[model samples]
Target: MYYIHLEGVPMQCVLVWLWHIVRSLTSIEKILLRDRPQTLYDLSSKGTVPVLQLADGSVIDESVDIMKWALKRNDPEHWYKENFDHQDGLVNKNDEIFKKRLDRYKYHVRFPERSYQDHRADVSEILNEYNSLLEPGPYMFGKDICFTDIALMPFVRQCAHVDLEWFNSSFPELGAWLDRLKESELFISIMVKYPIWNESESGQYVTWE
Candidate 1:
């Protein structure tokens, strides 16, 4: 699934779900091009992150919706298959509640009154739930990595960085999971620095060289 966003696409937590699925499937039968779908805004001016353009010149703009669009076509990662039960109605809840808290925690200045710890506390409760789930495993979905695991990781990864010591002290299991993701090749491929607007000279989606 090549996210056909113009110039390039910025790396975010949401992209991880689609990324893991695409990598695991490794099926390039069709060039799933993702672009900031041609929009009234992009048509008039620069639009959002997920403007997608299809081979037939079709387009999709919103990022979160795009993840669903890409995932629906394939189930190699079972993103839609396994994670879709309450995903339609409930996925957005976590996205709404926890995601909002995460962003504020990462960039606490916007929420000026709240200390970083206070902001983290708001989200840590959710992470602790995940920690309990991981009682006897590494990946969120049993032995291997799954859509559920990757979907929520990027933001958590960002939070872990907000205060490594603090997050470690507060939520060790979630912190451990974040630590594991940092060391994983997937994290290296997706999070590694590359030109946000241009593929490196080697012309890769991610180039950490």
Candidate 2:
């Protein structure tokens, strides 16, 4: 069976959503960051959530890597259809640039040196890039949801949540795109809350089938 250890957080949510969209049936174990189980430690010493344990016993811990693995197995919608370099470029920007800014903006207290507004300003150019990309169609790659859209939507959603008023006014296209992703079956299915896993219990795991 395909086994996944996840939390309800955005990165984990991305993996869950991708697996669901690809119809990758999996045994999902909900985890708590504060109270990670020994199994998690054994599987991934880094203790990262959204770790996927393949039936062969190999594991993939990175969220994006897990997405690639799932999609590579079956991409019915052709999320990676065309423009390989462009898709990789956008995904890279989201992960490398926007995500850092988003983290600082969302939890300004942790990054006390930079004001929350400063963090928001740092990602303005990236947001503008997304706005430009979406001008031709709703999805990032135009007319179809692709790797970049699913890869970056959660981070964008997090950013929009930071200052709803500013986000709506400053980036209307992005705000609408975020809304569309939030309302999709892919988002909704993966977002269902599950009780945190406990090793002491018997048959306590959940399966996303």
Best by TM-score: 2
Candidate 2 residue-wise lDDT, 1-209, digit = tens: 67778776555335434454443455667888888899999999999787878879999888878887767776778887688899888887777877888878788899989886787788787888898888889988888888888888878877787778988899888888889988987777666676777777531344444
Model 1: residues with Cα > 4 Å off, grouped in runs: 1-3, 6-9, 12-40, 43-46, 77-79, 86-90, 192-209
For residues 40-90, could you state the per-residue lDDT of candidate 1 as single tens digits?
244325454445555555566555666666666555646556646644433
Q: Per-residue lDDT for 104 in model 2? A: 80
TM-score (C-alpha, index-matched) for candidate 2: 0.90
What TM-score against the true fold does each predicted structure earn? 0.68, 0.90
* Global lDDT of each candidate: 0.57, 0.76
Q: Name the top lDDT candidate.
A: 2
